[model samples]
Target: MSRKKEVAGSPQRAVRGPAFGYIRVSTQSQGQTGISLEAQRGAIETFSQAMGYDLIEVLDDVASGMGPESFCSRRGLRSALEAANSNNAVVIVLAWDRLTRYSKFENQLRKIAFDPNRVVCIEEVELRQNGSKAAIHKYNEVMGQRISSGTKAALDRLRSNGVVLGNPSMKTSVQPLGAQAYSRKSTDLVRQIADMLMESDDPFSVPSSTVVIKLKERGIRTMQSKEWTASRLREPLKKARRLIEEREAPEPPPTFGMF
Candidate 1:
């Protein structure tokens, strides 16, 4: 709003040196039921001010986040990434879904040499990561965990509103398929890790190959979209063991000094 350089219709930005806003919405604009581009733009611009972003320009796309569409299909999002790379600026969004709800966007960002720190989400609770490869992977792990929670939360909300998920009255025609679809969710991955830790007497000395086999058996892949590796499992294994150790640690005796 700070006197942006406007064209006849659009604005010509690139002055303040670091920020691009990307917004995506479905076709339901003009006071529709769900969301409006105006609202998204306003929220982003306001957040930009507080975050000290120059807010070079705001590019928009009309699309639904629930689709399995690729990022290349989104011209506006692609353009925003290109522009961000050109200016070495940050790409800010109102929420993670405004960018994408899945981990696929990670490859797209890396392909264009975009820094992970530059991708900002106004409503994100996770901290941003640096441009290091390890940091990006760490960020992806955090996002992978957070992303899966939203779907279940939405379904719960629907149930609370008296909305039925599956047909309640219909009888099943076939037997239930057991573990037909493997879960790649972060929580599931953690549970697998915990199981491995419990089976090992020396949890700290447990090899990465053992954990990788467990993951493969469960059909879970790392955020990098491949079988788990030592480097990828390093942090999680240590963290999980530390957590277990903390949980099973005995409480210390009361101090000699009186309260």
Candidate 2:
């Protein structure tokens, strides 16, 4: 790792493949909470070798990831993007959060004409394979429905009227993508509730409100760790329906009829 390829004074170079490596540590010392700097490098190095990404340089950053972050704030990120632009290499991070805590990470990627598709998050890719990203993506879809309006509303209404909006039938199976800093509680609960409803003698008649009550009676909570509500159940409920359709799973044993 010490073999320097010298990307304008970058000290670390792992391989000579087409990919670039970037790692970050929010804590001042490597001993702080979460993955140490070396661990990230090791992962990125191994990934690059296996994937044939000639990782020339691995930029590092150590700073508090608070509030909105910009390329100007993190010199390492800025350098990585610049190098990516010049080398036409994709940037690699151990995880998306390590790249930047900011919600609008695309802003930085957009600046250097970097192909957003090329910015690979190793863990996220694995999660997609595991079907674990399903619930998180469902949450994001719900958020979009809440925030996007006007023309978006028009498009949605049109689609509801039987207008085609892309391929509505296309889908990828997603499982819960949870790691040390994440949790699969939300996904697991959603699937469980879905199974319960499906196993019911008459699932269509089982009011979601009543279901919420049953959940509270059982001391179950939402992904936010709050009491579940009928409205709160909407998105995940739809997701459950999709799973039932996609999986065509046999009716599981009665799991929630005891209530």
Candidate 2 lDDT by residue in tens digits, 1-259: 2223332443454544476778787767652532456566666665565554677888877865555654568778778878888887888787778777777767656766777887878777563432224323433444344456446878989988988886443443232222422446656877788787777876657788878887788887877788888898888777766766666657757885776
Q: Which ten residues in a row have the lowest lDDT in candidate 1?
A: 173-182
Write the residue-wise lDDT of candidate 1 on 1-259 in tens digits: 2124232433344344578888787564532422345556666665555444677788877766554475767788888889888887888787777788666667657877877677887765344222122323443454455456667899999999999888654445322322232333554566568777788787767778888787788787875568888889887777677777876899877984566
Alpha-carbon local distance difference test for all models: 0.66, 0.67
Give the Cα-based TM-score of candidate 2 against the true structure.
Answer: 0.42
User: Looking at candidate 2, what is the lDDT of residue 256?
Assistant: 58
Candidate 2, position 112, lDDT: 60
- TM-score of each model, paired residue for residue: 0.40, 0.42
